[model samples]
Target: STSSPSSSSTSVETPVETLKSYLSELLNNHNAKRALHGVSDLVWDEEVYQYAKSFADAYSCPADGMLSHSDGSYGENLAAGFSSAASVVDAWYEEIQYYNFNNPGFSMATGHFTQLVWASTDKLGCAYKDCNTIYGRYVVCNYSPPGNVIGHFAANV
Candidate 1:
């Protein structure tokens, strides 16, 4: 006896069909300018990064940066590094792991910090002021369609 016709139909998804699967939500376009409320323009400049690294290496918490006995440990060294970095900028934080010895990035550089201040009384956290320095941290932003897209298009036309 012959078996029933084997299933031969196969489903082929098309790009358009796949595209339809993607549901997009229009995130209300809060004016980027408005969203940038109280945004600090601090950026990581090469000079700043270099200076920061040097200062940190030159000075840092001793106990963390170096090994010593209970008397005058690397804590002093760590503090020194932070102090040096802070001298350049208004504020700085020290970051130190094992094997100190003037480790860079142990100190927080205000130059690399950014603060997004909303209209509310609350103050948003400070972003790395120098995140975008040529040799510094990375900075990211959520971009939206240009506010004057139509104007740009019209100009092109």
Candidate 2:
């Protein structure tokens, strides 16, 4: 039998990879499935949808032009990304707070993920009447951005 040193050591997953897997599993859970179905069934108030459309229209990309989807086919992907990122953020909110208080400058470099989530979900919140309450609570209470992180890029511009 041939044994290599590599085989003796256990593989270690990075925090990011572990978080990604956790988020993936969360989306596959029954509650997430139920929420998704509920979302599909809910209707958006036309006026709200129009307002959201206008907001999206007025929004411009930054110098790097990230999250720019000209044809608007990016909505679903954005939603998925936002949901995943939100899940991870939600799970780590306590730890994030500890880090923020204990280590002021500590950043996980998940800024892009947070930005993507905020941008996508903010639009959804505007467009979906049913989502407004939950989204409001999530943004205001559950998933507040860290002090150094910008919640919305367009807002900063």
**In model 2, where do residues sit more than 4 Å from their true spots?**
1-40, 65-157
Give the per-residue lDDT of model 2 (tens digit) for 1-157.
Answer: 8888655432222376663454344333313322432322122234433544444434332223233322332222112123444453344332333333233332444332322233223222121111222221111111112122443333321
lDDT of 1 at 46: 44
lDDT of each: 0.22, 0.30
User: Largest TM-score belongs to which candidate?
Assistant: 2
Each candidate structure's TM-score, on Cα atoms with residue i matched to residue i, is 0.20, 0.22
* Per-residue lDDT of candidate 1, residues 1-157 (tens digit): 5553333212122364432221010011112222433322222234333433344333223233342222211111111122122231222111112212333222223111111111221111111122111223211111111111222222211
Candidate 2: clashing residue pairs, number: 0
Clashes of each: 29, 0
TM-score, candidate 1, is 0.20
- Number of the predicted model whose lDDT against the real structure is largest: 2
